[model samples]
Target: MTGDLVTGLRSALSIRFVNTGTGPCTDMVFTVGLPPGIVLLGGTDRVVLPVLAAGRTHVHELTLQARTPGPFDLVCTNFSYRDENHEPVRVTGWRAGLSVRAAPVVAPVPQPTGRLGVICETPNLVLGAWDELRILVINDAGIPLEDVMMAVTGPFSGAVPRSRISVLGPGMMARFTFQVNVAEAGRHVPLTARTTYTSGGAVTRTQVDHLTVAAQPPVPPSPPPSSVPQSILYLAANPRDLPPLRSDEEMRRVKERLQLARNRDRYRIEPALAVRFDDISQSLVDHQPAVVHFSGHGDRDGNLGIEDNDGRCTKVTPEGLAALFSLHSRTLRCVILNACYSERLAWQLAPHVGHVVGMRSAIGDPAAIEFSVGFYLGLFDGHPVPDAFARGRAHLLSRPGLAPEHQTPVLFPPGPSW
Candidate 1:
């Protein structure tokens, strides 16, 4: 491997295969296995060579990009070939270690007004990924500002329209977070933050920041098939105070679809009924599932409804759920939020989870059930998450009276490559 090893930067990995035997090797295959926190920028991880004569050497190079800042190992998980005797032989135990450093932070320039300072913290975004853009408003003047309001403009925007602060005291700072969707790659996107405040008089100020979007990272190679079944944690909640939902029917449909799948043996569904606010963490810790499915209610404010201690409806904020999911990110592959107005939570969870499926608007019971059934069928048929999402939408479109809600379900970082 060569090049600077840094998070958000590109690097190169080189693999050399040598044949020292008396005869030539045929049908050689080499597969590179990437650890968590590392992403392949381009090219396929698996390489094949038709033939390699004795005393011959072949080299393969791959482009890599690191996501998290830490140490990771690159292993040759599989290497095999047929020898002169026409017998298949396998080789393994090849590994390389790399250390990736965090990207350097650039300091924001002070505003010319000198009364108020605005700083926008932009992140390196991958194409089609959802990320957060933070803006810091500092009161540097001797006087305080009242009725402070901030509105963001540009490619990145918040789920809600604007952010406001009642009052900003002198020498104090307030931070604002906005969820941004990266649509284009290999270009710089500009973001403007407009601030309005009331001091001795009303005043308005604007600050701009530019973020560069890198090309989409290659989907990591699939791991070798394992004997252990992939666990799906299905959580259902229908509090007494909220309208009734067909939670049981959804579970039954999901199980029936999976049972008829060709790869039914590769998946196991674990249900947690009457889920309460506290049951989420315990279920996750106990099951350690690869995929999580939540069927319940959601409010317009993007809060998910769960059961309270008294069996009443309780709301869970997107921030809280995002933080909780981040803790188990290494093992969690995808999350399905099958509730009304759950797109905001999908944006919040995108950075922590691989793929997220959420409802953009209110959907009926029949549409939701059909989407889930089709989604699980696609997954069992060996399709990627994005494709499965399309299959789910197709299910809605194909059914009578359900086509109107076909656009309700959305996949974050919408891309076929994912």
Candidate 2:
């Protein structure tokens, strides 16, 4: 019986009849209909009834194929021959009730084309702290999603109105800006949302987003604008730059090799997904950074820096560096030169940014990666960058001897804040 209902399904069901009257009958009829919902599979009148002699008591067997899940009532009619007079008499009252959980064939969850991939930008948070976030929902599917409703909790824990996200059509993107104000900070806040999408019928889902907003220290605001706008920029010369390990094959092999050698996650590799430098926002350029990492070559004495093949100098000049400061973001604090000779060039622009890191000598790829790995782990993982720099510099320094010379970071003094 179970095999008859398809494999891996709870196919057994029973509907007992109070009476299956004995009869001198010609035929029996069973009638049924689904209780509700579209029938995924059974029918009421499906069983085959055998011919019955005047006093024969036999079973009418039914093998059902339920099309869907619902409650249903079955009716059985026993029609028999009459007493040698005129008409056939109806053998009354043969009915039963059934509850079928015929599971519908599960369809694959379609890829959200107008997908609003819910992501928690902050991985941790404190109570009473606020997290500024932009929700990115992209419609990458074939259909457009409208009137999307969701219940958001944790970071946005409040009885707020269902934020109506506008229509996101295929390949288009829509952003919703919301702030999660926390009463406390440093705790991991769970952002769970149940989205109700009305695609003719309805599909509901709950997804989780983890956020951490640490208790940020209170800081003083800038002492009134200087009336002049300052600007800065981070030019990643990597127009077509490939990350460590050269070609794609080589990179894959090396990553595999390294994974086997040691757990990079254990060592805390701050793997920043590489993006084109030009893709950087204009606003970011307007806000000068405390540190800047130039991942290319620079020469101070030559007053020249290398550029990508497209001719945008991978290497920037002092004037170019000054030009970088002209954007609007001039609160530059420190610079980490993942490039060669950048430290030497930073001597002239010393006051622009604090703490300059450059190769006192020519730096190779291995050393650059080593430093980046150490520095970011230290920065993002709660360790002060100075301590992280020391640790990284020590790792290379302890290697017995290699490189163009001692690959040390040149420190430039900070203008104000440390």
Candidate 3:
């Protein structure tokens, strides 16, 4: 009863009817009403069942061709048979016994049968720069192919390169070149390639080649600081008249993990808690820390909540935050907003800072704590900002039964040395 239907091709279907009565059946007429969009190959829809004994079955098989591209239902419209007493019985209104769907005009190409091969040649790639890559496609099936097309995709600035060949004989090959670039500095970036060709009157597609784009050595910062410990300014804001948070615990875990890092001696943690507007500016002017981290509540409008003069919840706009960072942009290398809906602020601050990390959405208490711990752990181990961001994300993912929202933090303006 199950078969495939293709455009402009005949498809066969079979249906069975059982006689469960205790007596034999005679002079039975079976009629199937075919919906529009399909035509019977034989131009007839009725079949005669001469006789059927008890506990027996009769199968009706036919071939149908689709005229247009759509689905149609086959229904049993008429059934007349003589019962055990030789009395005629009629049945109707049996609808939608089976469904047939015509294939689309452009059917999906079949998968390649291990007949093609691909090899990629790429040099060591640098961040925010372009490099040349070569791709070689081989016909390993020992057969000729026609209308062969190949394409290479990557995180380049614009559209990737593609090439085509009319014919590829047995043991033949083709080569294509692409200018690929990756804007971010990370351990790996995926590059993919796809090929489509015709072999023996069949259109086939080769599997995409998943390749990795590696970054070169990072550019050293201007007069990079020595191995001496760098200071990180930790700030928290919560109104005195409102509910309290686990901010103290989050900071403690971060310090604990930093102490356990391989290079524990390379960091100086500074705290400027219960932060107010003046406190943020004063700390930046006095401490001039390499990194600044804020842990507090944030609103949907991209505003961070800081304490007012009376220790009441006060929302600060992103513009104000960006302006404050701009004043001290020279000394501040990174800013981390460990608060909800901070991505909007992160985008605004990216231009004024070397590195920015913010949460895209609300994060759970445990997730926020784990992320901070992992981030500092990476910094204490001498990892760069991008690597540290990835380590923090990995830490959240590594936890058991963690929700997807826990991975909401995102890094911006990538490939910075900080």
Best-performing candidate as measured by TM-score: 1
Model 2 steric clash total? 58
Each candidate's TM vs. the true structure? 0.51, 0.32, 0.47
Q: Cα deviation in Å at residue 79, candidate 1?
A: 99
lDDT of 1 by residue, 160-259 (tens): 3378888888878777666666565553565556777766444554434333323344358889988999889999999999889998999999999888
- Which residue pairs show collisions in model 1? none
For candidate 1, the lDDT comes to: 0.80
Alpha-carbon local distance difference test for all models: 0.80, 0.46, 0.78
Instruction: Please estimate how well model 2 matches the true structure, expressed as its whole-model Cα lDDT.
Output: 0.46
